[model samples]
Target: MKLIFGIGLFLSLSLLCYAQEIYKESMSLMGSDFEITVVSENEQAGAQYIQIAVDEIKRIEKLISSWDQSSQTSEINRNAGIKPIIVDRELYNLIERSIAISKITDGAFDITYASMDKLWKFDGSMTSLPTPEEVSQSVARVGYEKITLNEDEQSVFLKQPQMKIGFGAIGKGYAADKAKEKLMQLGVKGGIINASGDLTVWGSQPSGKAWQVAITNPMDKNHAFTKLPIMHGAVVTSGNYEKRITLEGKTFTHIIDPRTGYPSQGILSVTIFSEKGELADALATSVFVMGIETGIDRINQLPNVECIIVDDSGKIFTSKNIRINNNEN
Candidate 1:
């Protein structure tokens, strides 16, 4: 199951100036809802800018989609353990970054987690936990180290035949980043590409102020705990509250720890603010699996990155840099 985040609902009023008009569009992409907003002089110009973003995101989805049999990603998976498959430089670099992140998080953020068998189901069908042996066997082929990349040839190889890689963790964020870059290149002064909950924004809103993003409360999705002004940056939230199951009086979330092949515990949600969407997305998932203390410590070591973690008990823990509006801590 994929992790869901409470969408940052931004409520902005339009300005009087026609040159600073804010045009918005919403559509479904990559199995999630994507909303694109552009601050432009006219509606037609905004539509063109949005079309560019949409096309760029579709192009990225085609390159990294694992379900599409003819995609480059699928071809790479098809040759797993048999031979190395050469791929585009963009994909190769993305995979390379994924491995680096896996190392940084100590294997907590592994793309090879796709190879994990579905031993634990979050759906209502699950009545009890799997046996210890069953749990171990499920992650037999799941390891970031098993993915071998040849930088010279730009090829990827899986050590095991059953090993596979999926970008469910970071693909949307990458798409958002790429789309934003494309818009900027097209001379878009201000816009937002919100790929599901992983969002990237540049420039200010039509009101001549930094974009206001409301961080929704995990306990209450309708209400926001705080609103932050983002001039230019990315924000990603990973939460387990939406998809979970309770068995034997114990609750299990949808986010499975790549190292343990088990659902994460204690953390209900993790929201990360960073300069890059891909980094924010991966770190959000890493924080969930790393637990509260270790995750907070890890995030603090990195510069220009902040995180807010909500535990099962509804207590909020933040990195040194984060400042909530209402709460002093």
Candidate 2:
């Protein structure tokens, strides 16, 4: 169904001052909300930097957006099984990394997920489950193994005619990382690039306090219970509590497994902290599909990466390196 989804609401710590004020600009980009914050000397400089950040994100969209018919991503899909499409080096690198991640996650996170046919509805309209044959056929063309990459030619090709790729899950985070890089290169001392709930922050706020993220309590769903202080890193939280598909008396989230062609269940939300927003965003979705136990174990194996999982029972789980303290701000 070409689903474009993001996490729940996240609250950021913002502090301002007269000498060096914190300026923020919020806008819609890549079919999702984005906020760019920077530490600037005055309102005029802040405006210019924000515009620069916005322009960089727009450039990324032009490269990776599947909805845009002229985008390179669309061209790759159009040439599936016909011929390899030469793409920009940036795009080739992104696809290469995506394939690596797919291998490690055991098909839980696959860009070829776009190859799946939309056979289920999440708006309570689906009262009966699709036949087993229908479910299997929906994901027949969805396989990461079918995607081929040639580094020498900087080209991408799909072995199957119906195979397709989309970056709906990781594109926002990639754009956020790119925007942060552009802002930092232009001499912006401190800032944050928040693409919906996937965020990347560096330096500190103008008031000198470390950047903090307040994750929503799954039990409450509306109010945040704990605040996590991050000196510098990326945090991406993915959840499916808002949308669900009902078949018979069972309920399923909107996040479908590309391999099994079934909705992932058991975990309510997953928040991943990593060195890059792209990794954090993809890992968050991967954890959801991997379930609670396996997800925590996989995250613990990676160095400098941690995750917080809230299961359907409102119970919280964390990786080996994480320690949640509600007392600490």
Question: Can you list the residue pairs that collide in candidate 2?
Answer: none
lDDT of 1 by residue, 71-184 (tens): 999998899889999999999999999999998899999999988888788678887789889888878889999999998889999989888899999999999999999989
Q: Candidate 2: which stretches are off by over 4 Å?
A: 1-18, 124-127, 325-329
Score candidate 2 by lDDT. Answer: 0.86
lDDT digits (tens) for residues 185-235 of candidate 2: 988888888888678988787777888888877668778766788767899
Residue 157 in model 1: lDDT = 95
Error of 1 at 93 (Å): 0.2
Model 1 backbone overlap count: 0
lDDT of each: 0.88, 0.86
